[model samples]
Target: MLAAIAAVAALIVIGLIIGFVRGRKKQGLPQEPPPPPPEALREDRPKITVDAEPEPTQPLQLEDLVPRPPEAPAAEARVTPPPAPPADLGAFRSGLKSTRGNLISRLAGVFRPGRELDTSILDEVEEVLITADVGVHTAGRILEALRTQMNGGQLSSVDDAWGAIREEARNILASGGQGLAIDQTPTVILVVGVNGVGKTTTIGKLASRFDRQGKTLLLGAGDTFRAAAVTQLEVWGRRVGCEVVKGKDRADPGSVIFDAIEKAKDDGIDIVIADTAGRLHTKVPLMDELKKLGRTVEKALGRPADHVLLVLDATTGQNAIQQAQLFKDALPLSGIVLTKLDGTAKGGVILGIVDQHKVPIEFIGVGEKVEDLKPFSADAFLEALFESPDALDPSEEAATAS
Candidate 1:
């Protein structure tokens, strides 16, 4: 009975083991991780890529390895300086040839190798001075100084006489006051003169000088009576790159100048140069007209014109003194512009003008050239006037000799 019972238990255990194995098969458990999804196993599936580097067609050169310079600009875009113009006239010595020759020759003629100095010698010198247009007053003063020197035994030779005269000229020139007072902004310059005294040319040259100084300038064509005058001033304005304020033909000059000053004030110009009609000082009506213009300038500027420059022809000689005196009486003539000095032997008239009227010579026109119109330098004028031919440059000496 024990043996039979044992056999049945064994059978039950075996049946239990087989039933467990069959239950696992029905669930279908994977043996490893099961093969990947069928879609992932296809040949066209996305894959990671690692590309090889590209090879150059040719070997590199040293220049190719180095960075290249930037390309040059085109020909049309290039900038070049303009060619130079004709040379300018330089030095006062050359310009004073005529005056120097005339005065120096006459003075030199008086001093021969053995000419004795006497009272009659004084008379001859005085005559030469007067003939040179040194006014009676200036010549008298120069002679008086020489006589005092001679009495004091200071003048021993003709050389002493020459020295005395030179000293007197130096004193007279030094007495003239300082140069143009450009102390104010928009320095108003009123240029007045009789007809044909080079007023237009002087104004043009002045504009050139101011332009070179880099100052902003305005020109007033106050000579509205003459259409040519306005046109000429416009030409100068264009050349100097300055603006010109003008009015209709025969417009009131005072109105034109007033407008110019107003414009200059509005534009903040550095200078205002006004051109006045050429009117004779002897004419009462004309003189009154200038006086009215002066009033207009003062009203517009809130002050008197900075410079009332009287332009006179140096060739007018003593007549220039009369003109200067009359103009001084009519207006506050601050300075004088002596033109055509190179064309005349009467440059000595400068001495006379200074003696008669204390107005300083502002500028002197020694030639027709713009550069020839230079600021008056007393020392330079005397030096050039009395400079011996030997002391001058070859060109100046040649000019004087001629």
Candidate 2:
């Protein structure tokens, strides 16, 4: 009977617990708490942590989207300019030393302290100038000017005479003008000369000059008579980093030059330097051939060649004058390039060429270096020719002493 009473107590406890759970469900309590809000459930949602101080935000601006140029001062500070140096005339003096010795060294005895500055001394000066290969006309003109200066008591010594000569030389060169005209694009230059006047070498140096100016250049090996000339020009082209247009060993030079100009046009080259065969200037047929070549250049370029440069050897002295006369008569000579100046005492031939023909000396080959082939400078040449070896520079003094 006791066992039956314990079982009935256990059933009453179980029934009470079931009735409580059903009452809670009817009251709508959550089975596992309703899911948090979508924002809290999303793992990717940005989370903001509390901070002591927050940065202030500004609205987007159009200026901010555009690229900012560097500040002016900052930009300027970044660049270091190159130093500007003074012009050095030492090279001019050194190169003209031989000519100076030839001309001025003779004047040292003529204008000595014991001698009077008279017509006799002036005559002596003229003789020295003529002997140094200054043409007779130029020498006479110089003597006439010296006579005037002496009459006015303007010249008292060798120094005064030098000043007068320098002035005259300067005036003569200035009359011919200094610079080469290369204003047009693909300026075509026709280089012509008699045999062994450094025509090919001058062309090479000229090409080097244009190349250094950052201009594109093309060379025409029109000196086809001499295979060596064509080969020399090709070597220069390779050295200077330009193209050389050449024909066969004995091709007509005019056609070779004509094709070079055409090639220049097609390639848009900035400068075209054409070399013609080294013919004898005295030979009419050869000169006619040169003229024909010039015509060919004009035909190819659709205009006259920009420059017709006659290369002359300074060592030829007054013979160079004859060559210049003949060449100028044949071609519309634009300029003259006097080479071998450093090797000759006859550099005075320059004054003769300019005074007689009025043809400008565009370049002078002072030394063998490419840089030695310098643009004609009236002031520099006069300074070099006239200045006392001791006055302008110590290097000049040293050169003289040597």
Candidate 3:
């Protein structure tokens, strides 16, 4: 019994030692919990994708294209100017060579481009014109026109300003605005002027004009006092295919006119141009004889001298103006016929006559030939005065407004 008890005690002790070692090992084994579900593991972890998210963007601006502009006009950009005829484009008259000599001289002086005109020079121009037989009133107005042009920035040069004066004179002459009216009855042109003013020559030329116009023409040698008068009228009458009435070198002038006009009316003549004895302005009695002759024609024939053509010598200068004034006062002068224009340096007499007498220039005798008489034109007269018209003129003539 005692041996058995010792063996059992040894076994018990060994078993106890083994159990303690196992407990310690288990405590060191890191206390691992039981395994969780697979779904719970996926829910707790992070996720990844194949494509990543993009970042932010930006914007645009201005100074990006061309540099400058183009040169010429386009193909469709053409314009048209106006027509240029019947315009005051520098055409000259052949006849103004006579009746407008003084105007020519004055215009020449004004067109020479060197001198400058102030009030003093203007006053000199006035004095020169007035001395040349342009009346005081006309001279004053012309100078005033120049002064006004100077003040208005128009008449810049001395040479150019006279055109304005010339243009003004043209306006005055054109004031006698009646055109030559042809009547059914005979048109009688009675020639009157101071001696040496080309009266007889003008009568012949006038008769030629009428004859050339295909009219029946008649002439009267009314200046019977002059010894050569009858012969001269007969010469002109023959030259123009005209019939003439004359006296025995010293018959009453009135009786001769009466016979001529009566014969013209009887013969169905279209015009009768009568040559009167040239008289001085001082001869009032001789002029009264003309008035008495006028009365006789009025009584004998229905047509008196319908047109009293005053023949003037353009070279006569201021004397022409004086003559124009006297003749206009004495007779109902219809128009002026200027003669003896060749070789005249001073042509201002035309302006003076126009200014003083207020008469229109009807014809100009440029030469001794009958065909030398030319119809009066203000524009042509202007060009004659200026020589060349395109040289910076102020006379644009109210046209260029369009």
lDDT leaderboard ranking = 2, 1, 3
Candidate 2 local Cα displacement, residue 350, angstroms:
1.0
Give residue 201's error in model 1 in angstroms: 0.9
> Candidate 2's residue-wise lDDT over 233-271, tens digit each?
887887777899999889988889888988888888999
Clashing pairs in 2: none
Task: Per model, state how many residue pairs clash.
Answer: 0, 0, 8
CA lDDT of each candidate? 0.78, 0.79, 0.67
Return the lDDT, model 3, position 400: 21
Poorest stretch of ten by lDDT in candidate 1: 79-88
Candidate 1 ranges with C-alpha deviation above 4 Å: 1-90, 389-402
- The C-alpha TM-scores of every prediction are 0.74, 0.74, 0.67
What lDDT tens digits, residue by residue, belong to model 1 across residues 192-229? Answer: 98878888889987877777766788999988888999
Model 2, stretches more than 4 Å misplaced? Answer: 1-88, 152-158, 389-402
